[model samples]
Target: MTSSDTSVGPSSDLSQNAENFNWLLSRFAGNTAGVRDAIAVSSDGLMIAQCIEGERADVDRLSAIVAGMTSLAGGVAGSYRLGTLNKVIVDMADGYLLISAIGCGSVMGVIASKQANLGQVAYEMTLFANRAGAALTPELIRELKNHIQV
Candidate 1:
């Protein structure tokens, strides 16, 4: 099977207690020009948080897609002896999807509109990812889960 078809592991049974994750995402999305949405997922592909409007089904599907893409990217990097992969960016005709590693076992995905400022958005995403990673510990996970509905 392709790397994208495979899952890595199980998500934490526990959830996060912090409600600020949404606020953080909102600030990120709102501050950036042409940001379509932003999502946070566990390393194993579970939807943790997002800054978008949709039903659970849509959010879950997007989470899975992000997780799958992340897995495939890491696998590809490893195969080429690229050491540890930091992020993955897929540029499309209509928009862009950028994924970056968070903490030890999570990912942050950002979707940008076609008119988005790629450079600034990318830089901000890096900073956002770093902050996310810093907050991905057990305690923070609980906060994240509590704050996000998905």
Candidate 2:
């Protein structure tokens, strides 16, 4: 994972928050047994933060996938008169891709191995979202967008 360049932005608070977000995501992936990678993306598909063992291109691809999945799910929910789109789980042969809303117009995407405990990972994702959602304001998102790691 690429560290946020604190010196690149003007607001220390934003920088600190970005760092905190990165740390939180790192912990979520590290502490969870089945989790392989995770990312936090804005409503418009911008990557706010990521915690993955791959290159930047991987992060970008995940961001796009998350955005598309959420959009399609939301559409489905509306079409079927579902109250709200909560989560979308894609169970692949090797692993799973789970996308869930984290509030404040953002969503969290997690990739977990096939052997991972799905229930446990879902619980952890909820915890992480609740803790990080409030801090994901528009201003911080803008700052994060401007200085996201390449």
TM-score of each: 0.79, 0.87
Q: Tell me the whole-model lDDT of each prediction, alpha carbons only.
A: 0.70, 0.81
Candidate 2 residue-wise lDDT at 127: 90
lDDT by residue (2-34, candidate 1, tens digit) is 232221122354334244455566677768888
Among all windows of 10 consecutive residues in model 1, the one with the lowest summed lDDT is 1-10
- Across 1-150, the per-residue lDDT of candidate 2 in tens digits comes to 345312222335557887777677778887899888888889898888777776677878999999999999988988999967677899999999999888777999999999999999999988998888777889877777776753
Cα deviation at 109, candidate 1, in Å, is 0.8
lDDT against true structure, model 2: 0.81
Candidate 1 residue spans exceeding 4 A from truth: 1-17, 146-150
